[model samples]
Target: MTPSVKKIKLGVDVLIENDFDIIENKKILLLTNTTGRTSSGQLTVEEIQRSKKCEIIGLLTPEHGFFTTVPAGQSVNDDIIFGLKTYSLYGNSRKPDSKLLKSCDAVVVDIQDIGIRSYTYISTIFKTMQSCAENGIPVIILDRPNPLGGEIIDGNIVETGKDSFVGIAPISYIHGCTIGELAEMFNNERWLNPKNPDKSKCSLTVIKMVNWKRSMTYEETGLQWWPTSPHIPTVNAVRGAACLGIFGELGIINIGIGTTLPFQYVGAPDFKTEIINDDIKMLKLQGIHFNPTKFQPFYGMYNGKLCDGFFLTFTNDKNFAPYTSGILFFSSLIKYYPNMFDRGKLKQNSIDMFNKVTGSDAVLDALINKKSINDLRKICNKGLDNYRKLRQKYLLYD
Candidate 1:
């Protein structure tokens, strides 16, 4: 076996080393959580206090709350620490208001991202930037690695009308860029600034990471895996999320929300694994294998019900196309459960949610038109190719 390697130095690490001077004496508001740590595992907030360059007047917590304990979609409350108040960015309001930024001179964002659009952290970043722009505050992003790697850009761009908290920008579902790079894209593209272009654009600075590469996954970096959210319990879960998460939006199947596997398990009470097990096995999906199993979710969709689902295991991290696998799973469900499946049951929320998450109605259109998996993959790949070329200008790492 090869010797275990340590993780690369994070943006916070570099910030403390050299960028501290930029924020010196400024009353700072940190838009981060517990995952913001130094390369040696020290909490970023603690490290910042140690540096003593700027005053951390308060903190802003995102969807999962500061420590990442709150469940998905649940409202969070303020937590007090060291006499400073911690505001809930995920609750009451999703963006910084005058009260939240009171007495603050600048803002610093240092959160770990999984490199997907639907993940709410990036939306929080977008909203934070917008708020800062409106308030004329300079913002700095202590950029972290995009665990999925930056080289693999996939999925369709989110149409402007379909934007939501899950996706505020027009980018691929699995956007392959670091948080810093995404900030740059958001700033330069004027996705948020166009509304108030007359206002002074918020000054954006990105403290880039050291010794990280575009092709390296979190596993390759040898970092301790921390679940970005509650259901995404493992790094392996992140690998499959781009596909599994889309299925969860339909609100019919239980994507292991109440179980240990979350995103790794896909099934419904009426979904008979044996019926399509052979068909799915024949798809020969890249970098993944399937095991038919049954589970009972304690919460979320299909709560307290036995679900006949398949457990997905990724075999090749780099080759797997999650959205294609999702389309395959979706089309397979329609083929086997024509009578039982009901897109109508989802109502408007599910339809809008699906379109927003997948970035368009093309997948649904393909399903409705009875398009073959090969043809669907071809269309999706075309979009991916375009995104890869489009993202070339914003990439920061090699």
Candidate 2:
């Protein structure tokens, strides 16, 4: 074994090895998906069930359902898993109803969060925590790696009153914290905002993973990577989603949703990569660079249309800055595709979505007003310093 490599144990392993005392003698409503598996590749549901330390009364799945066959932005349906009642948390309303809560004594969240704010897994857990708070039920979160490493906080905090299913919390776009750690912050920060002030905080127990350091990327943990969603098939895809996700929301450009390399590429039918490629390179996106390429998406925004863009090249994962490279890339795009960012050109709904994902309309305001790329970058990083300070205490790993 390499001396610098540290083998990490997941929270699921810690739960079992610790004898599952947290959920012992309780009826649990487990919130998990296909990604909720151990380092050894065993499903967390099966392991917890096999331990016989707690009675899993029901299963709660987030965006992609039990099998993760569901597509992005689509609602998942409730299904039966192992003869237990399974409820869908990605339906019309994300929170569980009173009847479902009545059936379980506690809520357990074991989903793998990729640490991006726009990703819906965190939102599901956030809403679940709210429900648990109001019902006086405790929530146990099986913590996992942040994937982007817990050291990198990117983008700006979602501004006040900009909360949505995607921007559900006032967190940075790439919040460098685990689901368990975020739960701690959520509870302490009183972001749950339950109907009753007294019930505003949920009792959250975080079963932390062993050997997980803030600076260690998911690959360094020496664990297998499971696609958090259909589009994020690999670690690089996750990075792509962080950097290029905004473009997807605008629908003005194709961000590789339909291709096998979803979120890994960006372009339009008339993007003219040659005109913009050199400028993008000049930005000197740290740890990453790109070369012009083209592809025809089978479906999605640019279905059956060939797009002109570049594929990402990462020289170093540790130094790869998703937010810096992403916002700067968008800034560069605005200069070339000025009309695309025009308020008149963009749909109001799409504009609203972009604002929600970014947590503010500052970027949109800057873009529409013909602001420089540096202006847009400043807007993107507006509250980053304060957010880092705010998130300091909630950090669970070094």
Compare the candidates by TM-score and give the number of the best one. 2
- C-alpha TM-score for every candidate: 0.92, 0.95
lDDT of each: 0.80, 0.84
Q: Candidate 2: where is the Cα deviation over 4 Å?
A: 1-3, 317-319
Error of 1 at 273 (Å): 2.5
Cα lDDT of model 2 overall?
A: 0.84
Give one digit per residue, the lDDT tens place, for model 1 in 1-398. Answer: 12554447788888787868888888999988888887777878888887878889998889998888898789989898656688888899999997666568889998888877899999999999988888888899998888778766667777657788887888887888999998888887777768678542678999888878887767677677777788777876887787778777767677778887878888888887997888887887777777899888888888889989888887536776776777787788777766323556557787777777776777766776778887787756655666676678788888
